[model samples]
Target chain A: MARSPATSLLPGITIILAGAAIGAGALTYPLGSVFRPGPGFFPLGLAGLLMATGLGVVIEARGSDAAPPEPFAWGALAGVVLSILAFGLTVEHIGYIPATLLLFAICAVFERFRDWKRLALTAAIISALGTAVFLWGLGLPLAAFGGA
Target chain B: MDLLAGFQTGLATALTWHTLMYCFIGVTIGTFVGVLPGIGALAAISLALPLTYYLDPTDALIMLAGIFYGAQYGGSTASILLNLPGTATAAITCLDGYPMAQQGKAPLAIFVTAINSFVGSSIAIILVMGFAPAIAEFALEFGAPEYFSVMLLGLVAASTLTIGSPFKALSMVVFGLLLGMVGTDVNTGQFRYTFGLFELADGFSIVAVAMGLFGVAEIISNIGQPQSVIRDVGRIRMADMLPTRAEWRQIVRPTLRGAGIGSFVGALPGTGPGIASLMAYATEKRISKTPERFGHGALEGISAPEAANNASVQSAFIPMLSLGIPGDAVVAVLMGAMILHGITPGPNLINSEPQMFWGLIMSFWIGNLMLLVLNIPLIGMWVKLLSLPYNLLYPAILVFVCVGVYSADNNVFDIFVVLGFGVLGTLMRRYGFPATPVLLGFILGPLLEEHFRRAMLLSRGDATVFFTNPISAVFMGLSVLFLASVFLPGLRARLLRQKPGAVAED
Candidate 1:
């Protein structure tokens, strides 16, 4: 159950990066007038808080005597990331049905699905049912075929 | 007389075909999710949110509410029969429930839980029917300062109740607040955290974040663990599922106590069924003359926490429906669903839309009854599902998450966001950081910020507005006291020592 200092340090880095990005975004908009709050005021304040908290976590973790952190689950992590990317890339071109089928199939691989037929069938059925429900039942403007 | 009339109207609305069908669907889906380990009710509601877009708002809400409570009942089954708790709230059930099953009394444990859940929910429903409007009316007097204080109390309570490193929990809450900052600024016309992404203009989709954190991250966690055999307790016969006279007597006092604790805890902002269940279990053990018998298969141990959890689930709606501030993540998503359908929830909602209010209230009763009936027959089926290979089950979950997120906006951007959140969630879990606080923070973050800003504006930059409002002042005082109690070394040590049952269970 012990966590490594690296585990804490990484999130600190993420917070810093997120804070910088948010702070940069805040600069683009007016901070608001003296009488009224501006669009950027909240974001700027929040970014500062995020950076401070992230830094605090890193410092606290470094000083703690807890167990070292375990290795990250990279395989499952990569599968999730790749599936999402594939979905985003294919959704517009192949449409919802095909894109979802591919996404599901890719995700199934991480779940240890070795049989191609089972994975494909499950993905196809899921895609078809999802399309029918969201598009036909709900009347959402989900494209069926790529052009449509 | 008014309470009777409200019930009569609620019954009329709940009896309709549309409402009944939705209730059935919600309870059925809820039971499945509840029985399955790792997939919580929050994910179930978030996944179902898109499907409700086509239904009438009342029916949709009724269905969602059914799922919320139904999950509470269903979660106990796995906890009692197996070592695994289907949800965190059910974790307490496992302390004694699994021992009961090991002693060949799984059905008895299930029976006790069922009755307890029924009693807990029934009491809460009666209170809601009788007192919701009165509470709503009283809440109408609250100004921005009061709302801000309430939100502040909620964040603090959520942080304290969450399991794991407090620092991580606080960080997650802050992260949630930052996430809430995405999309258009309500007071100003400009967007704050969109980062050139038009898709995020409406804010990071609640469905995306919820599903990613609960659903997709769960799948990732499961993948890392070695696949183990899903244990099946023999067919649960009706005879075995009925509680004996001795068992009933053992559970009665605990059930009543659980109901009382659950109702009050559930009414508090941020604390919900999860905290209530833990507290109820610990309290029951403390009051028992023979505390030594607790983890060794005591029916009261199973009954008190299970009953309290379900009761708290029903009562948690009080703050959400009456005050318009969701108490937890599930309720937060429920609030989002309501807003998405153009139904504004608040003090005036009951007055403005009595049918909607009454229909939702009525549907909750029907949903609870439906869940009880649906769960009994399905217990066998769920036990059978435990035998299914994780490989097959995990893929189906991913498909559900993928399709569920895609349907939210018909945009691929959400799909990407879900993946990003999935990674974030997995990392959070690995580091022992609780995800629920993040959810609470995300849902309440904007409301907090808005109210805080407004309070400041009205006070002309003076922070004393928070202290000036009587209601807000009282809550802030309590918040400071609670924080001190939690952080002060002597007080923390004393509180920890007093809750010996919780420590043992942990």
Candidate 2:
């Protein structure tokens, strides 16, 4: 669990900044009296608590044997993120089937065994099953080929 | 309602063809995911949430609860056969179960776990049937102050009791609370943190957030990791599965003790089956005269914790049903499902929805019996499922996640919400923040705040209203004690230092 001091402190700083952002946004709302709390009351309290915990994290990190964080799996992250994004951006526009195939195409980048023919077959099967189950069977108002 | 009447209603509700069919579907899906390594009960429940939009609320709840306890049964199959736990709660089973499997006693180990799981769940179900209504009756006297204090205790216990840096978990809880504040305020008609988007008015979709955190994030982490190879499970005759008289005698006492521990722990406000199983395992080890025999295939090792985990999963429903408070993240998602179905799960729920409550309880008995059949006679089928390639499985899961998120509101924006949180969840995983606490805090935040504000309004802004109420005061004191348990080294060492890194989300 050993790590350099800077790496150990990174999480604490990140939390603090997040807390600050929450607090700043909360400040825009009216702070009513405790007798009649307003919209911002709970969020402001949460933000303060968040920042305090962040400080506690910092202190604890310094006192304990902190380990460096694991490196990000950029390939996996990108593949998943891009695939979901493609689906989200085009689902309503292009509809479920095309959007789903696009999702599969984007996700294929992270696969270790990418036989195109097999992949295409699997994707088609998935699309058909998804269409049959979610669209036709459940009667969800999704278009199979185009925008509903 | 009288006991006989409740049973009659439950039997009538559960025996209907559609209800029985959904129960079957739920347990089947539960076993499938539980037999798999990466996908867990939480992720599976979230995926099924959108699909259940059209079902009756009672049926939906029945199916989802089946997935939960069904996963417990499925998890042990992997632990015993492949030495790979199907779920986190089954991790303890690997200690003795794998050793027994290695010794060609796999059939015996599998039999013991399946039977013990049934025993544990049956006991817990009985407890739920007896206690839930009584607890709800007591909770009917609670006001806003009591609700706030108890919820505060839940959030605190969730953060502090989990295995990790308490401060990091606390940060995630508060972060979740902040996320929960992103919609319109009910007290005033003002939009909060909406940034001019109308979709944000109702709040970030709970399904989207849950999927992103548990589902998408889990897939991202599991992807690119080397998949474990499944070994061939040799032929097993039915005769091998039957326990000898001595083995049966050895298991009975441990199973009973485990059920007791699991029911107690699972009924608590912030604990879950993972903790219950670990505590049960430690207790077994401490009391055994031959502790040295434990890891090498002791029947007690496999029996107690399997029973404990299953028992805990069933008993965890007590707090959720009685107080509308979830003890863990999965139950929190289940609570979210109840809310989505237009049925709030609180003190008035059992009285208001007796059919739903009693029927769900009765279904547990039916579900457990079904699982005993599925796990024992059909064990070979699930073992073959273990051989499915992760490359194929994850892509399909990704598709379900996308469709599921979109289907929640027919909004593309929710998918984006899932994506953003997916990245955030990945980063949190890398940084060692526990994700389960976030979900718990997110679900409880709005209710906690509502109760806090209401209590204050009634008390004329008097902050001490929490302490003035006896029920609220007890919970507040427990919250303080939980905090102190983490900060005080002596208490922390005594209470939580039991098998560190063992307790985790189911």
Candidate 3:
């Protein structure tokens, strides 16, 4: 569970970059006078604070005890991201039912549950329930199987 | 208004069929999620947030609040039965709850915790009635500078009080503020960081952010993890639930003390039930004559933390109701719900919206009573629910999250935002950064900036106004004190070697 020193500093480094990026973006807007501060004033101040705290973290992590995080679930991450993406991409074009089925199938593939028959049955049941609840009951603007 | 009038208004609202129906739905969902191991109250609330969009604001709030405190009552079931915590706040309940179950005293442990929870919440509700309006009245005189300073203290206190690196936590708050700044700037009507996306003008939907951080992120992390199966504890009969006379004596003092500690901690701007329960458990062990019996079926162990957690959950509403400042992340979402419903919660909330305020308070009693009934008679149902596999639950959760966010604005762009944040939240969790403060920061960021700018304008750019105003100065001083507490401990540890005789206290 012991973490490498370089890995332990990753969070601080990430925060530093985020702050710098935000601060640079803030400079494009008006800075204005202190009496009448512009839109950029608060963000610029927050950027500086963020970067400073990030630096503090970096300093504190030096020679400090560290433990590695749990193993990243790449497959799970992909499954979830893609499933949601599929729903977003298809719900309007292919409609809610197909989109939902696609989502459930993608999740099943990544989850390593190979029982397609059962997956389809559950997917159909879910699609029917979602269509009933979100479409008919709630009157969301979406068709059942065709494009909305 | 006086307490009696307030209760009457509350009862009038809470007793309505519409409010009661929603309250029942809310507590039912709350207990269901609370009995499950992986899905916490935060995720459950976010998922349910969309459905309440069409309801009355009062009903919506009653339901959301029910989910929160109801989870506290139901969380102990998993801890006592399976040694697994149903919610993060219930983690302390596992200490003696599991041991008691192993000792064939599971029914007694469960019964005592339910009773203690009821007692704890009753006391906190009394305090809420007595304190909220007074605090709100006192806060009515707050000017822009005072508001800015108090909010600064809340952000600082919230970030520093958490159990992690203060630097990391503070950075997360800053990160959240940055996220909040992405929308159209309200002052000049100029877009600050929309990046040319038309939808970004309104900024990220709070529902999207909340669901991604708490719901979708949780689902992603929970996937591929091995889950423990629940073992049969047989039927819990009514006869086995009664505690012996000695056990009853042991429960009374601990429950009262735990309620006291919980109310105090819960009323603070940045703490919540998790800390309250932990403190209650530690205090009970410290004061016990047989301290060694702790974590080994000690009757005092389960009762104190259970009472403390429930009491804290109820009392956490105090800050939100009085100052419009949420005490924790879950409450932040509840606050966001209020904003979405076009209701601003603050000093004027009680004065302006007496029915909404009092109705929400009264609903807590009804909700707690419903939970007692559900947990006792329907206990076996939840135990059976524990055996439901995560594989089936997660995909459904994913679908609900996607549909829920999309339905909020009827826009597909928000779904992508949820995806991006879901990934970001997962990385943040893995990198030792706390996510709760990020949410608190996001919700408070716009309000914070608005107050800051107004305070500056009123003072004619005199930054010292924050320090010169008495009320504002006290809050600023408190913020500094909180910040110093974070850094001083580390500095002291570096400066002096630890002596055997000197014990470090939290």
Local accuracy of candidate 3 as per-residue lDDT tens digits, B1-506: 99999999999999999999999999999989998977889988998888889889999999999999888877899899888788878988998999999998899999999999999999999999989999999999999998988888888988877666789888988888888888999999879889999999998899999988878888888886887867988779899999999899989999999999999988886677888888888889989999999999999999998999899889999889999888788899999999999998899999999999999999999999988888898889989998877877788788889889888998999889999989988887777777888888899899999999998998999999999999999999999988887779866344222211211010
As for candidate 3, its interface RMSD to one decimal place is 1.1
Q: In terms of lDDT, which candidate is strongest? A: 2
Model 3 TM-score? 0.97
The 10 consecutive residues of candidate 1 chain B with the worst lDDT sum are: B497-506
Best by DockQ: 2
What is candidate 2's lDDT per residue for B287-402, written digit by digit as tens?
A: 99999999999999989998998998999999899999898989999999999999889999988999999999999999999999888887899999998778777778889998
Off by over 4 Å in 2: none
> Candidate 1 falls in which docking quality class?
medium
lDDT of 1: 0.78
Cα RMSD, each candidate = 2.9, 1.4, 3.0
Q: Return the candidate ranking by lDDT, descending.
A: 2, 3, 1
TM-scores for every candidate against the unseen true structure: 0.92, 0.98, 0.97
Question: What is the C-alpha DockQ of each candidate?
Answer: 0.53, 0.81, 0.78
Distance (Å) between predicted and true CA of A22, model 1?
3.1
Can you list the residue pairs that collide in candidate 2? Answer: none
The DockQ ranking, best first, is: 2, 3, 1
Highest TM-score against the true fold, candidate: 2
Q: After superposition, how far is residue B229 of candidate 3 from its true place, in Å?
A: 2.0
lDDT string, candidate 1, B1-506, tens digits: 26667677778889999889998999888887788776778878988987888789989998988888888887898888877777767888999999999999988888778888989988887777666788788888888899889777777766654444456666677788878888988887587667689998899988899888877887787676665557758778888888778877888999999988888778776677877888898898888999999999988888888878888888888877887877777888898888889887888888777888888888887888887777777788887766656655666666667667777787768888888898888877776667777777887778888887888788877788788889999889977876675456476566545333321101
For model 1, how does the per-residue alpha-carbon lDDT over A22-141 read when each residue is reduced to its tens digit? 788887888864345677777788788778767766776777775555666687787777877887777778777777777767776765546777777776777777678766877656
